[model samples]
Target: MSEPLVSIRSANLFTPNGTRIWKDLNWDLFPSEIHALIGESGSGKTTLAYSLFGLLGESWKYDFLHWDVLGYDLSYWSGPFGEELRGRSIFLVPQNPNLAFHPYRKIKDQVIDFFRLGLRSSEDPKEILELWKEMGITRPEEKWNSYANGLSGGEKQRICLSLALLGDYRILVLDEPTTGLDANTEKWVLRAIRKKSEEGKLGVIFISHDLRIVESMASRITIMKEGSAIESFPVKDRKIEPTTEYGKELEKARRFFL
Candidate 1:
């Protein structure tokens, strides 16, 4: 109904050496909608996420027919608007949480830096603790003063989530949000994401290799293969019946996870 929060048309992305990574991408995400991009590893899911935030590596090149977000063409953003867009319009929750945090800084200080740079507001330790609690981080106050290098993988992931939430972003790109967590921690992380989405008109592009999780969280799902989107379907479209090749593979994956 309202203007689509983000739109991509005829988008083609390539890595250096002229290896095509993603081609002919066309999609629209509305405000508050959760769109899932599912595929096997190396299917360009992360590449798409990086490109959206203008974080594509130097080796990669893209032609964005119409890549617009919040009424601006992202490809054309420069100067202060580019800086503003990074924190205000779109945020990325990286797959590897360890890559996001600095080992030398206290975690709380890192959060404070995020708030100062992105939010242009002072950090509220109380608010940060509250979000840590909501994300199921244990000993929030104690952990706040510790360095990221000291936290476990799951703990680091939660901290990464807190950093993203500390900013005011309309859209969040979650790249394999549950990759390294144990089952229990995975559930906790997923619950936190659900809670965050509930409170804001947030558009999310949730990327995952696990179809079951994608089916659970996504309103619309796109299946990618070999750097291209091979199928796009609603999660409720049907269950894996094992009657087709891809369907058979999907069934096998489900059974393996089970």
Candidate 2:
């Protein structure tokens, strides 16, 4: 196996009020692989997503016995290097797509600004347009001029995915990225994601509660419960259900597994 894109062992995260939100977390993700983190709400899945790029704010404290992401040791993550790695090396697509863009700015302008930041390796507008079309945006040229408020939820999600693909990021963290999409749109989006991950050698951290989608997309999965990882396993060719009691419960709830 190639080197992991992210590796964390004995990690913990605490809120500003000193309440522990994550406990003893151990996780790993490798290049060109889709690793799914699945659990119910408040399981700290999204918190883990934000924690990858150290976006949990100063008040929140995070500690890891071994912390590394995209070849950088993040055990003592802070300062200029931390600031530089967030959007450039590790790109996160928030659960709420609205958080990704300026509400008042046109999408075209924001794309240009992101390009100018030198986060992405390529500056080709045509490539961006190609991704838009692949994401099922008809007449992406016209959509480019519209504001964030103008696009539908699915469009916003796809736009964020496209930006992540175009950027130079090695790891893409997606938090409930397919939430608002219809079945057909979801299919297209997933196809595009698979294409990009394989072609670009991107490692994807897919956090979603929907087991059906998780089963379809993920090569491996980690089950989280109350801020802890209970089990992690390969899903591609396994005929039996997960071994852990919690994982069995999850499988029962989902009614099926790959």
TM-score of each: 0.85, 0.90
Least well predicted 10-residue stretch by lDDT in candidate 1: 235-244
Model 2: per-residue lDDT, tens digit, 1-258?
899988989999999999998888999999999888987788988888777766777888877798887767754345567876675677777899988889999998998877677666558888888878877888899889999999888788888878876787688888888877778878877877888889888899998877888888888898889999988988865332578988888877875431
lDDT of 2 at 196: 83
Q: What's model 2's overall lDDT?
A: 0.82
Error of 1 at 150 (Å): 1.5
Q: Specify the highest-TM-score model's number.
A: 2
Best-fitting candidate, measured by lDDT? 2
Question: Lowest-scoring 10 consecutive residues by lDDT in candidate 2?
Answer: 71-80
- Segments of candidate 1 deviating more than 4 angstroms: 77-80, 120-122, 182-185, 237-248, 255-258
CA lDDT, every prediction?
Answer: 0.73, 0.82
Q: Give each model's clash number.
A: 0, 0
